[model samples]
Target: MSFQDWEITFEERTEELVEDYGDSWRLKFDDNIEPDNPAQDWFQYIRGAFARFQCSKCKKTWPSRRVLVVFHFRLDGRKRKGTVEARRFRQECRRCQEAKMEEPQFDSDNIEVLLEKLVERIRMRCYRETLDGIQRDFRPVGRSEGPHESSHCEACLKGVCRKAE
Candidate 1:
């Protein structure tokens, strides 16, 4: 179905999600389904989810009502401060999915590509959150010149400075 067609159904699902998650607003899909293009399906599911309301972050009506999809990964090795890592999928417009379906078969290679995309998405989201937190904490300090003007670490100071500059 076209995204426009899917939008109608997606709206209905979003209401259910609001009732279910309330403030948290997280939706986890079962991985067993094995969609033709799991990444596309993942995007479609999230787009459907956000169709219900305005996004808290962007404040813009969710474009195509899409939600960023991230895949969480953890290594089996030694102690790490943060055990989980994530990556996000590229925004898959519904048109892409429809077009992709015309191909003969969606195989493991496709899924692997999707997995990588999801991982990237997660990493970007995590980085964004970290930056946002740093900004929130340091906002009161006001903009400053020179390295030592801000109390934040050099990395953070550099980032903020770059953003300002």
Candidate 2:
């Protein structure tokens, strides 16, 4: 028969073999096996997989039991000052006492890297928005004399102050 016909026959035979063997024989199925109901979308699967956890203290529901860990890194070239710290906190429910513990799988280094990546993404977006706003408001006014310089904007300054408090 044709290649397509042979392939279909082989698939049917494999299913039959699996059924005949039952639990006694362990067959390693190929990863490419299609789901029975292929019409199910990814969103439906994700929604089903994502279980909600209720906080015992406040009775508030969370998407999952995982807690968010925030890492702060500061560097001041002029003063030669640099520091890195990690803080773990859970989104508080109606009542504040119940806090979910973060997954133990994430090590300090992993958390730090995640924070670094997040900061990079935020910085990129902030710079893009600032450039757009500047282009809209003021003319080039001729390029500056030295290398490019950057300073903490008001939002970043406020965030730093809040964290310190």
Model 1 residue 98 distance off true place after TM-score fit, in angstroms: 27
Cα lDDT tens digits for candidate 2, 58-133: 5654442222333333333345332323333323233455354322223233333343343343233322222222
Task: Supply candidate 1's per-residue lDDT for 149.
Answer: 23
Global lDDT of each candidate: 0.26, 0.29
The number of residue pairs in model 2 that clash at the backbone is: 0
* RMSD (CA, angstroms), candidate 2: 25.0
In TM-score terms, candidate 2 sits at 0.23
lDDT per residue (tens digit) for residues 1-165 in model 1: 233332333233334323532311222333332212333213221201111122233432212112223333322223321122222222212222222111111122333333333333433442222222221111111222323322222212223222222
Q: TM-scores across all candidates?
A: 0.20, 0.23
Q: How many residue pairs clash in each candidate?
A: 11, 0
